[model samples]
Target chain A: MTTLYHQPLDTASRCVRLTLSEYGISTHLEVEKLWERRRAFLLLNPAASVPVLKTDDDLVLVGAGPISAYLSESREDRGAPLMPVDLAARAEVRRLMDWALVLMEHDVTGVLTHEKALKRSIPADHGGGAPDTAAMRISRDNLTWHLDYLDHLLSTRDWLAGERISLADLAFAAAVSSLDYLGEIAWAERSACKLWYARVKSRPSFTPLLEERVSGVIPPAHYDDPDF
Target chain B: MTTLYHQPLDTASRCVRLTLSEYGISTHLEVEKLWERRRAFLLLNPAASVPVLKTDDDLVLVGAGPISAYLSESREDRGAPLMPVDLAARAEVRRLMDWALVLMEHDVTGVLTHEKALKRSIPADHGGGAPDTAAMRISRDNLTWHLDYLDHLLSTRDWLAGERISLADLAFAAAVSSLDYLGEIAWAERSACKLWYARVKSRPSFTPLLEERVSGVIPPAHYDDPDF
Candidate 1:
């Protein structure tokens, strides 16, 4: 059986989980508090990042991009293809996935993880310092620009990215859901984006993700509510 | 004929150039000053990113991942095959590529681009605005960590990542080269990484990339020297 190492509140982890479920692959989910830096988890992924998938062949895949690519090839028939077959369409999907994962989540999720999660999970030997206010401020400023870009993209497409649902939508939704849980989204300013979120939240694969709870961090009331 | 939309000094653009050359593909290079943000260029890429490829079939492939994927599938011979046929090895290669493009570049090249290139290239639109000191500072702090990680990885391997010289090496060298041009690498502190870079710099495909010069920026004297 395939095993997935992840944390409950990690958006990238949730994205992988949703993809796996969509493909009808039953994975042995291992919840890892990565901040603890357990030796076993480090052995699997030296990068010490979440969402590491250990395949039945004993190959450990790190990062969502690789995981999605590998699974897409392995389980083509079970789910809507995460990447298109046509070269141009595939390129668009990959670009949008990068935009969501690298551009938006890099800063926005970094802020939320450090500000909220890291404080509670940092090990004693790791010199648990307070979240850097300067980094948070920069992240906050960057968020507005990114959100506006998403709003523009959502205005024209039913999904956050390409035609029909792709990994890009799952990636963006996972990040946005995490931010929403932290009450970080400027909802009124991103009305179009919010509407798109409604569509993603309505999916069956997203149900398990929405119900996930992280100890000491209760999600906002609207997080699990599909109508929100 | 294949047409590449690029800027001389752009590292990501250079990565694509090296890959194309290695694959023995002759391309018509159209230099686009990404800093200029022309209307035509924006239409091609709303994210205003560089390294977009237009193929003979009129397919516009954006970003290094998609472009590399397209090229790898299009050709059977020429250069070292960057991606592997084995599913496990392929996953590892893709993971390393993502790490280089998303994680490392986000800190290293992004800082140089925003702090130096953007200010110089978009001065009229960014008139009198203070440089993003926080972003620069975080980048400076985070860079050493990445360098250390690379040094550790390259200690027993010839490449920055994986057994073969894959896209991961190209992506990493491109990001590091951009920073090295800005005098950002602490060579003495990362001897292993420097040694690995010395090997990467010697490839024939890397020659044209190293020789490239941007109008306003002067590269380090050692930038084009393979022995350096």
Candidate 2:
């Protein structure tokens, strides 16, 4: 009986949810509106972020990195490890995952989310004013650049890091999926990335993410379509 | 022998150097001026980041996250693991490391480095312009806030994550050390943080980082002093 505190459209939370599914771990989901900064949630994560997990033993874990690493260290009955057994391959998995965590999420998904979703929800006095169009444009260009890089990688590798699905795939897929939900990805422009994403979409783990809905925001028509 | 591509005051590179030293691995150091964006360096890391490790076996590991993970998965002869063998403890270590990487580095060190060092060294055309005073002020406040959090953690725990010295310590100490080199940390204001840092600074693995010299920028007089 693990409970995961998350927000539906939060990219990090989505990544954790996907990792949990891949590991075949069932968790009770609780939505946390981080902006509200609830006292109990703040105690769970002083950083005031989402995706805090409480294990069956009641050990609390905060942040996507901790949750991802914990889930990857599998026991015999849980599932096969999401991390590669080989050392070098494992490094690649971590490298790709880090890239997604720092570069993709921070630069791209964060930009899009702030502009597309968060701006409309929170009040202006709390630093949530009108969407910064200039920032969004730059992020869009950056997102395209990242898509080119992903396409280059997908041309050679079946998964983001290597031949098999790992946390890297989960991370990259989660990042792109968040922007896709906002209708920001130019899928037709990058055939390799589209093909790779289509494969990710078919996975049962990703199904939960597609079904998620924020309070007042509706996803684009192609948001949940694997064939799109 | 391994080769590490790094910049002298780069926090991520310093973290990797500390990790490698902790594991007793020797490597040739190559200072990469990231702003220069060398073609070969870009080949090694498409992300154009430093602390790219080329192992004796020719496996290239980029970023502190991957490099730390690789170093921690040590064989008996290499060294004892810097990560705790227990699953929950390992998660705690990783949680703190990620907090350092994402919160401390992104918010504080990046701002200070850009303002105090890299801005003067790199050209305006490459996006290195005059330091924004408002941004620097905000970052300074953020740095103080983080130092307070670090002090709060160290008040009860022997190390940042736990009693044992782990990669969490290395990651956080590296971040603060870089900022300390720039004379940004107010040691007098936070006694506990200063005490905890003194312990980290005295470690043999931290020796090389203290001795490093960037080409143009000079660190403060007390930068290398373990007793400071």
Q: DockQ winner among the candidates? A: 2
**What tens digits encode model 1's per-residue C-alpha lDDT throughout A1-228?**
999998766777878988888777889999887767889888888778888998887888998888998888666455447766665676677787777776676667756666776666666567455767788888888888878888888778887556788888888888888888777887877789988998888888888878877767787888889998
For each candidate, what TM-score against the reference? 0.83, 0.96
User: Per-residue CA lDDT of candidate 2, range B100-181, in tens?
Assistant: 8777877889788878888887889987778899989999989877888898899999898888888899889989998988
| Candidate 1 chain A worst ten-residue window by lDDT | A75-84
Misplaced by over 4 Å in model 2 are: A76-79, B76-79
Worst ten in a row by lDDT for model 2 chain A: A73-82
Chain B TM for prediction 2: 0.94
Query: Which tens-of-lDDT digit does each residue in A81-132 have in candidate 2?
Result: 6787777888888888877877887778888887888878777876677889
Let me know the TM-score candidate 1 reaches against the reference structure: 0.83
Give the Cα lDDT of each candidate.
0.78, 0.85
Which regions of candidate 1 deviate over 4 angstroms?
Answer: A76-80, A116-148, A154-156, A160-163, A184-195, B7-9, B28-36, B76-80, B112-145, B160-163, B183-195
In candidate 1, position B63 carries an lDDT of 85
